[model samples]
Target: MEWAPVCAEGETYANKCMADAAGAQIEYEGECENYFTKEQAQIAAKKWLEEESPTFKFDGIPGSIKYIGYESYTCFGCFGFTFTFNSSHAGYGNRSGQMLAQAIANHTILVQTRGKNVSYALTDGAFDELRQIFICPAISALIPVCGTDNITYPHPCPAMQAGVKIAYEGECQ
Candidate 1:
């Protein structure tokens, strides 16, 4: 007997494969919600952080974790959430200063605001590097250098290393 595909929303498909391809839950009988709870969001964020850097420690307070809510921007609908807390860097030598170190350790959860889809992955490439930039105290002292992309770098050296052209001195602001 051929089995028909039934989605959580009671939508039927031609076949199980087709329903699966459409991102529908196969043989799922429970109700589905389009929203995620704060707890669920926290778990997703934590899991992503762990996967990214196993040694990284999130030294946030007991109640520091929160769901800052979501906003729509861009094609995939970017949603942002953050958890503020001090991070512990017992093993890795502190590259960024204490203030920047703490900030770097903090968790910034970014996700696509799609229905019931929680991506536990840091999709932003510059996130890690930008966080490091915040840690560099020399950034304030270094002359601002503009790259070919119009991004302001703390120093010309970094701009050159990043393979970007220096437009001018002084911060990119």
Candidate 2:
């Protein structure tokens, strides 16, 4: 909880909308360029500048998010962070359940850095800080992919970032 001081008192939120995936086409305002690997980030940025958009999406490769665009980057860095979007903040409660499912399928995320290596934990509280200040703005700056199969925009939208699989039990009716 390194960024605990920097983050707002409440960072996690519960859905107040729906239990299905989002169907509305929410377009990101700018572009999202992060690298789970340095080389890939470089490559993505280059392509983004030339093409004018980040096309990175999560590949359904266990812990992989897909990156797409009209171009490429010099490098995507090294994988060590789990990326996710906090839907509660996005105000997609009605579409929560479905969005969660789509997120699991896409798995887009960026690599967390530590000085010069991948730390993979929110030690400095970068994630929390981003949640309070950076997340929504970041999403607003990028384009949201239509389907939840790939990681679009800033990636791993807080709504559906990659993380440990949650174990759920059937509700007793």
Candidate 3:
């Protein structure tokens, strides 16, 4: 199964003015989600893997998912282009929320159809998937997004904190 939070790579992804700083558009297909923090992105990958696995044969090969971000920065002039996954701009209504994609199907399932000038992403069922995986309460997992956990999805994955084993809260990506 594949999943990704749908996004248009244009028109100032975050709440910036209509002007896209880069004056360039970039869109993504397949499993993807943007997050301000490396921890948040890893959390999302883990969530998606857990949600998608039961439907597929995700065993010794791989189970959960995770990611480590490289360094990125931008002023308001280019923040939108660089930060497409920020909660303030993505589907989440508030900046306090994090951008996450729980897997359902691949890119084919993310969009219903391409519109005249716009394409839409289908993220309505993510909350339901989160409920299914966590089983009790989504946030109840003792794992903190930034700590060292042997339980990371897709074992032997990306190195965290500039090649250090422990991941940090900010600036990894």
Candidate 4:
């Protein structure tokens, strides 16, 4: 997510936090004309992870870890990167079954990057904000809605929890 300030003289920042910190009035609904795409962001994140934290493991076996997904947010004035990983299909003893679910639902790998520098936060999640989705109540009625992220959520809570705006009422086409 990139931000361009409301004023013509204002500069564009990588994310919202930078814009806010710089006292730039941002047009939140729109994105800057030029910014790194999701692919670039993911690549940078993966490269940083593999190179800087080669010893990191999700569930005892580093080979079983997978890059599930990622989301970008702002921090101060520098480029901020947060990468979250999860256990793979091959599960081991304690980190398996329901226990695995609970563990993943609660923790994540947070990696931050700035220029050639990288650091680890040691705790976080890809959809930590939407963690409730994992325990959503069994619905007797289904009220699906299409989210601005172009994904269909069973109910508004899932999308809302994930910080996704409702685009329309129904599944995405």
lDDT of 2 by residue, 27-57 (tens): 2222222323345544443332223212121
- How much is the lDDT of residue 74 in candidate 1? 37
Model 3 clash pairs are: 2-105, 2-106, 64-153
Q: Could you report the Cα RMSD, in angstroms, for every candidate shown?
A: 9.8, 22.0, 19.5, 15.0
Please provide, for model 3 over 1-173, each residue's C-alpha lDDT reduced to its tens digit, 9 standing for 90 to 100. Answer: 22333233422244222123445343433222332243443343334333442222222123222222222223111110111111112221111233334433321112111211111222222321222221123333333333244323221113221122434442223
User: For this target, which candidate reaches the highest TM-score against the unseen true structure?
Assistant: 1
Q: How does each model score on lDDT?
A: 0.45, 0.29, 0.27, 0.49
Ranking by TM-score: 1, 4, 2, 3
In candidate 2, residue 170 scores what lDDT?
23
- At residue 134, candidate 1 shows an lDDT of 21
lDDT (Cα, tens digit) per residue for candidate 4, span 93-162:
1322233332433234555443234433333332222122222445677799999999999996677566
Q: What digit string (tens of lDDT, one per residue) describes model 1 on residues 58-141?
A: 343344444555554332222444433234432121233333333334454444333334442232222332133222224456
Error of 2 at 29 (Å): 43
**In angstroms, what RMSD does candidate 1 have relative to the true structure?**
9.8
Model 2 error, position 124 (Å): 20
What are the models' TM-scores?
0.34, 0.19, 0.18, 0.29
Q: Looking at candidate 4, what is the lDDT of residue 112?
A: 49
